[model samples]
Target chain A: MEPSDLAGMALIAVAGPEDALAFVSSGASSSAALEQEMNAVLNDSGVPRWPGLAAALLRWRPRLTDLAPERDLRVVERLGGQLLVPEDPEWPVALSELELNEPIALWVRGRALVIPEQKRCIALVGSRDSTSYGANVAMEMAATLVQRGFTIVSGGAYGIDAQAHRGAIGAATGRQFLPTLAIMAGGVDRFYPTGNEDLLRAVAENGAIVAEVPPGANPTRYRFLQRNRLIAALCEVTVVVEARWRSGALSTAHHADGLSRTVAAVPGSVYSANSAGCHRLLREGSAVCVTDAADVAELAGAPGTQLTPEQLGAPAVHDGLGVEDLMLLDALPLRSVTSVDKLTIVAGIGATAVLAGLGRLELLGLAERANSGWKRRC
Target chain B: MEPSDLAGMALIAVAGPEDALAFVSSGASSSAALEQEMNAVLNDSGVPRWPGLAAALLRWRPRLTDLAPERDLRVVERLGGQLLVPEDPEWPVALSELELNEPIALWVRGRALVIPEQKRCIALVGSRDSTSYGANVAMEMAATLVQRGFTIVSGGAYGIDAQAHRGAIGAATGRQFLPTLAIMAGGVDRFYPTGNEDLLRAVAENGAIVAEVPPGANPTRYRFLQRNRLIAALCEVTVVVEARWRSGALSTAHHADGLSRTVAAVPGSVYSANSAGCHRLLREGSAVCVTDAADVAELAGAPGTQLTPEQLGAPAVHDGLGVEDLMLLDALPLRSVTSVDKLTIVAGIGATAVLAGLGRLELLGLAERANSGWKRRC
Candidate 1:
């Protein structure tokens, strides 16, 4: 094993990310060097110990000595994933913003290209038991955002998170870009909530499944709470679709707020208990109310920046139409034919005006007469 | 006729509240005096014309000469209401806060006690075509506020406004105190939307029906918009229960914001088109999100100040019960008897604990045995 791999594995075995941060800040290059410095500090009465440093070193010394770096690497490789250390190019720089609380290392499954720059990612999260309103909104927002060249990041749970990934995958047709990521509370090798195994595998094929723990680790309640911080850290903006009071999604928003990232929430009915946390956040001035994708995009500072005509593989149409023609075209049915009477009512124009407008539209090849009524041409 | 009444009547006949304010602020207190001053201003090039003053005075000069204060007073008296000038003690001082746009006078029905001090009043306004959810919320909030010593103020329209007045009246039993005021766009004598005439009569008996225009005036679209300002100015806080885009309630909120008063909006489902304006207000930071009467009360600066036990005509009961006993008492049926199993489930307590709680509650005379189980005592 490489010396740096030995140091990373030893740090993970002995202590959490905070301990590794402390060791790095102390200018120690390896686990052996860190141990020597920590022991000297513990022995000297004159030296001031870092907070929790002495106890952490004492607790981790035996585990550090027993850690098998080679075996851990083999496990990660056998799972068809890679372990990313701080020095790796694929490591997200946004995680470093967590400072001492940053993950010691990330166990990642999927192509390395799936890791997005901090600015191109957005976190969409909400209640595990979301309402249909929430799920629809999450899916629509995720699809719209992915089509606009944004990669969605979220906890890989049921309801909103699953819908968000599904929406992004639906938008990823014929595209080489990574569109979504599922940040897991447990090891990526064994997808937690085995019901979502198929969905997670699909995500791994197109984007990534990421975790802070090693392979085969089971998810725990505490790990879920800790996992939220990584989602908040990875994205530039975190939007909560719906959450009941004191939901874990609120913890993610709080984390995003602590990170000075934009936090937004979609509002729901006051009668709905599911929307309580979002209303509380809006009431307390902790989160901005976002109603749609355009709202989220504008708040994230990328207004009107959707997929280009070239990216969409279609030339921009309808620009040459007059205002009245545009209105008539919009009122025309795209599938089933629409009668002129219906068009006039829908377009709020007189019958004579509608007939005239339809003629112009027909001349422009935007509309065509069917067996019974006028229809929009593809 | 009294000269002051002539001046007031002439101002009403000539122009709107804005013109009346200009004439009064010119330091001319009578019709003849104001006519002379306006003529002088029109004749002099040095004096600046108040924005539409010239055109208004010219347009109304003939009508002002033809005005009859005695006929107007008789009209007011015939309707069984009073015409209140600024000199009247019952005149709402909060309306004066509007400055140049304050009403020339108010046509008021019912006892004088209904007009509240600025700090003791809150305006509840919303879409005239409110949903059941909006109406329910408005009614509950109105009832809660009236019980807490606040006089509910609102427009006398259907939907949310009618429900607000109804809720306030429901809470006004046994108390001679007028707990509500319904502000009208037209005369209080002939309620517009004759469908609500019965509700208006009930409001006048228990509280007040007020209008900016004279008894014979019809409610025009412009007058409705103008009347919203009076509702906004007469209260300390204006809460919009539910509103569609471009609703008059939004105009009221804007007026409240212009006055630097607290503006709050109840959040509802984004799917409900009626809630669009309210969500817009929240997103634009023009209003805070309010879910219940407690939220409104706290924002209006009087929290937890509900009706006293004496005012409620009963000494407070169930205060001395243990937490579980109180919960069990609450779970007990008020009208019908409920079984112990139901109580246990409702209170989420063990059956044994529920039986013990029931014993304690019965001892306190809060609950009594019925044919099948226990019922709450009146």
Candidate 2:
């Protein structure tokens, strides 16, 4: 190993996050350079120590001597993963925007594909105990977004997160690089929540499994909170599908909000406890409510761009409709069947006009007669 | 009948809405005074006629000569209703805010009680073909608002409207003057949707049924749209519980928005067709999402004051909790059970702290362990 690599490994092993941050902010090019500055501060009687620096250096000196950088490198290589430093070509530059809170290095498992532009990367997160309604919404949104050439990023946990990864994988068309990415709290060598082992392995094979810690690190409570900031920093927009009040997903949303990234949340029934966090976010003006892939795309700065020619199958015959017919068509319910009387009320048109419009729509294959009355065709 | 009454009736019978508006805006206190101005307009050849006034006068001349005010009065009186001119003490002053569209007179059924101040009235409108979810939200919101000393106002149609009135009646405590008001599209004497006859009659007994036209008139498509303005004008806030795209309830919301009244909408599942209009309103920045009565009340300018001392039974023991405990309590799911592990994730705190907080909450009867996990108590 190079001397700089050995020094970087030692610093990561012994120094606290704030210590590493201070070292980098001082313009130290390498761990050895940072150590030299620390020694100068310690040796000079007149020079005052920076707040929290001297104490951290004194505390970490003994531990740095015990760390084995070569052995750690061997373990990472044996697990088919690699350590990524700031100099690595595959390093995500967006994390640099985090400044002081940025990770010193990243442990990555999977192909070292180039990180796409921020606009094409999105983070989807939510409650681990999400309802079926929430899970379905997350899956549909992920699949549709992936097909639109956007990469999906999420935590590889249960419920909404797991569904998001599965949806992206299912919708992969073999064209986009790294269709999904899972940022884990623990080491990339072992997936937490053993129940998601297969899913995480699939993700590692096709996309990436990433962590801030070295190999053999266990997922802890504090690490999860730290992991959320990385997800927020990596993407242009972060969407919360469903979260009860205080759900960890909200932490990701807040971090995204703090970073000035677009934060969108999927709204659910007001009565659903699982949606309480999302509603609170909407109520507090912290997040915009997004219903589908188009809404998400719009928030990500790509408005009016979700529906391409190939995805739409065939062009709709909307040009042929008159003003009244167009109003009636827009009034038609997408799901529930509606009657002529109700249609007249909804369209604010006369019964005769509504009936005539319905007839025209039916002939055009845009509407259909149901037992209840009429419905819009999918 | 008096001569003034005859002239007033004659003008209503023959003049177009614009002509009537022009006559009213001319500041003529009595029908006799308006007739003198009409004659002056006719005698002067050089003076240009106000836009549509000349054509309207020519069209109504013959009809005015044939109408009888006494017979119209008898028709209204025989139906156990009364006519309310602008001179009547029971007139709702808020309708004046509509300016050009304000009704010349209101035919009112049931008791001629004084119309409450605008701040005390609320309008709840939605699709006539409502889902069970929509109806439930409407009913709960209406009932809760009524219990908080606000009158519920809505169209007396089937689905959401009927449920609003029923909920208000069910929650009446006999403390407020009028518990509910039904703004009819047709004449006050004849209910438009016969299915709601009993409900409308009950509303007439406990509150009032108001209309712009005289007795024996049928509800027409144009009248329904016009009637929406009255509902919007009479209330301080208009809440759309559920509406499909282009539903008439949206007309009411638009009118309310135009009048600068607070427009709120209840959010539902994205998959629900009934909530599509509400969601659209939220997306377009036309309405705010409202979950409960307190939310509606807050937008109506009565923030944090929904529940009365008598209604609260006993104050919650929240003051004793520390900051972290309060956060955990707020994060607790109202309906769905949550586990301690999930709580820790949501609170972004240590698992040990969450476990300790849960134990304290259980002891205080604020939270309890459920089949799935922990949940807040009602």
DockQ of each: 0.11, 0.13
Candidate 2 docking DockQ: 0.13
Measured by TM-score, how close is model 1 to the native structure? Answer: 0.70
TM-score of each: 0.70, 0.71
Q: Encode model 1's per-residue lDDT on A1-378: one tens digit a residue.
A: 111122333354455556674564464434555566544544442334333334333323323433455776788787677888777877899987775467777888875434788788889999889999999999999998898888889988988899888888888777667889999987787876888888888888878889886676556454676789899999988999998776789999999999999999888887787788898899888888887777788777886545333223334356556554665676788899888767664554446667888998888788899998999898
TM-score of chain A of each: 0.68, 0.69
Name model 1 segments beyond 4 Å from true: A1-51, A111-113, A305-378, B1-53, B111-114, B305-378
Chain B TM for prediction 1: 0.68
What DockQ class does candidate 2 belong to? incorrect
For model 1, what is the error of residue B249's alpha carbon versus the real structure, in angstroms, after optimal superposition?
A: 1.4
